[model samples]
Every structure is written in C-alpha cells, then in structure tokens.
Target: MTARGYPKSYALRRGVILRAAVHTTMLASEPALGGFLAWDGTDYVLNNADGTYAAITFDGSDIVGVFFDAESSYNPYVSGGAYDIEIFFRGMPPRLRSLAERHALAYNRQNYQCRSMALITAAFWSVDDYLTAAFPWEDVFRHGAHIVRVELLGDTDEAWQEWREAYQCSPGQLAAARALFWRDLSK
Candidate 1:
C-alpha cells in the first residue's frame, strides 16, 4: 500500500492535480463543471466552479465505486456557467485526518456515507456560511487562493454533442478530443 493507504497501483502522487470537466446530466440543465479531482483515502471531491462540491470514490480511475454526496441540491450558479474547484492536499495535516475519522465514526452511526453529496453539500454550505458570516466577501477573497478556471467537458456521448455544438468544432477537431484525456507525459 502507498503512504495514503491506497493499493500501490491505485495511489496517486502528491502535488499532481488532475482536472476534468464533468457534464452533469443529473442536473436539470446538464451543467458542465470543473472537477479539481483528487484521490485521497477512499474519496475524491468534484469541486464545482460555484463553490459547490461533490465527493465520490473510485475502484479505479475509470470506475466510480461510490458517490458520497450524490443527492445534493445546492448548486452555486457561477457566471459563464463555468466553475473552479481546487483540491488542496498539501495543507491537510494528520490532525485533519483524525478529525475526519472522528467525524466518520459519528457519521457512520447515522447509516450514511460521509462522502456522499448530500453531506458534502451541507459541509460546503456550512463553510460558506461561516466565511460570509465572519468576514466580508473581499476578506474571504483576499485570503483564498485565486482558482484557475478549467472546462470540464463531459465524456458522455450526449455531453459531447452539447460541447461540440457550443465550441463549433469540425470533425477534424472532434478527432483530437481523445487526445485530451491521454497523458502523453505518462509515456
């Protein structure tokens, strides 16, 4: 197992962030949002551009094993319909894991996955509320890092149609789409 306790093959290196666009069909508008995308412990966060968040776990990079916050209703309606999500693994110390474990123990007693979207949404909203209540938006903005916006285009066939239509791409350009997911550097 790796230091984070994931199987050797499943472990992702520290400081490497993988960003992906997820076209959410589950939403009424099928909104596309960026996923800050990290694999920590058994969970991953799909941090939406509007400050909303989703938590999930994978059996492998391609197969989602569980969706922690699957039923959340809070969506941050950011401008341009684009969202930025950041996963800050560098700052999460061991104490945070201890706190999370304690949270998990109490949480599991309720017969729900702590990683679920519903729970994560509550956490996100709680944090946002606390920030807003304690400080001005400018103060919060100044303290927070400037998140880079990235397009999280969905890989689904239907999502592809929407993306193609929006980008006005020709067949040739469409052919290059597969290249986007391939990590040439891994070679």
Candidate 2:
C-alpha cells in the first residue's frame, strides 16, 4: 500500500514558523498572541502564547506523533492563541475520519461503560493515533478537522431512558462516561 499524508521531503526548520489556519477565528487575529513558534527539536516555543506547546515527533519529514504533557495545557482552548498551537491532520489518508467514527460507534455499542457522547468524542480525537502511525505529517498540510459538541440530553426522563435503551447504554455507564469527559475537559 502507498503511504499517505505529507511527502517524505518536508523538513522542520528550527527557526521557521508558519501561519496556522486556526479553525477558531477569534484566536487567530490577535497579534500579541502566541502564534510565533519555533521548533527546538523537542517542543515548540510558544513565543508569547498563553499556553504551552506539545512535543511533536518527526521522522525525517513525516510527523510520527504529538506528545502532550499531562500537566501542560497544549490544547487551543486552554491556550489563548491558535497559530502553531493547534495542528489538525486532515490529509490522513482517505476515510480516516469515517473509520474513526465507525470505531467510536462500535466501541460504544459494545462497551456499556463507554456508551456516551463524551467517549465517542474522545475516540474521534484519539483517531490521531492511527493517523500518525499510518499517514504522518498530513495533519499539518491538509485541513479538514471540525469538531462539534452535541449535547443530546432528552427533554424527559422517559424519553432519555428510551433513547438509552435503544442505544443499549446503561445509566451507570453514561455517568462514568460523563465523568471521564469532564475529567478530560478539566485537565
């Protein structure tokens, strides 16, 4: 099979910085923000950004992975800026998104403890693991990352219970999943 994503010729220059097309427009236009970034062979320099940078692993020109510190705020929501702070791998092979969505659906359907929108969302985000391994560096070049938070809380208890039964989700499982979701968000 042919390798996908960024070609084998892209190189990370130490002092080079590129303007990131941040999906959040509010965070992209601030001049005093942390958009200015530089690669230090380990992590990115925030360059006045409000948050920390995640460690990016590159194999020659291909991005093998991104390592976020457990305690560091590497996500754009926590970080006030967007440029160089957020990286989305859209060119991570065809059907990667669909595959991840399928995986999430299957996982929730099979695991009672993971039957929640939160876990599904997490699964979608975690799809980057597969993308990094299979496609590499494509997140940086291609753009198609869109995240929508849909809170489908039924209007009534009976409705909610019916929906849960239809989806085969247990109340305890949903509670645990919600806890996990909050934990990740609070982190």
Best by lDDT: 1
lDDT of 2 by residue, 12-126 (tens): 2211121111101213334433444334453232222322222333333333233222123333234444323113334444354444333322222222233333111111122
Candidate 1: list runs displaced more than 4 Å.
1-44, 60-119, 122-156, 165-173, 179-187
Reference-based lDDT, residue 30, model 2: 42
- Against the true structure, candidate 1 reaches a TM-score of 0.27
Model 1, span 30-110: residue lDDT tens: 333223444356554544344434343322232111112222231222122322122222233444334443432222122
Error of 1 at 114 (Å): 19
In terms of lDDT, model 2 sits at: 0.29
Q: How close to the true structure is residue 100 of candidate 2, measured as C-alpha lDDT?
A: 35
| Model 1 lDDT at residue 49 | 47
TM-score quality measure for candidate 2: 0.22
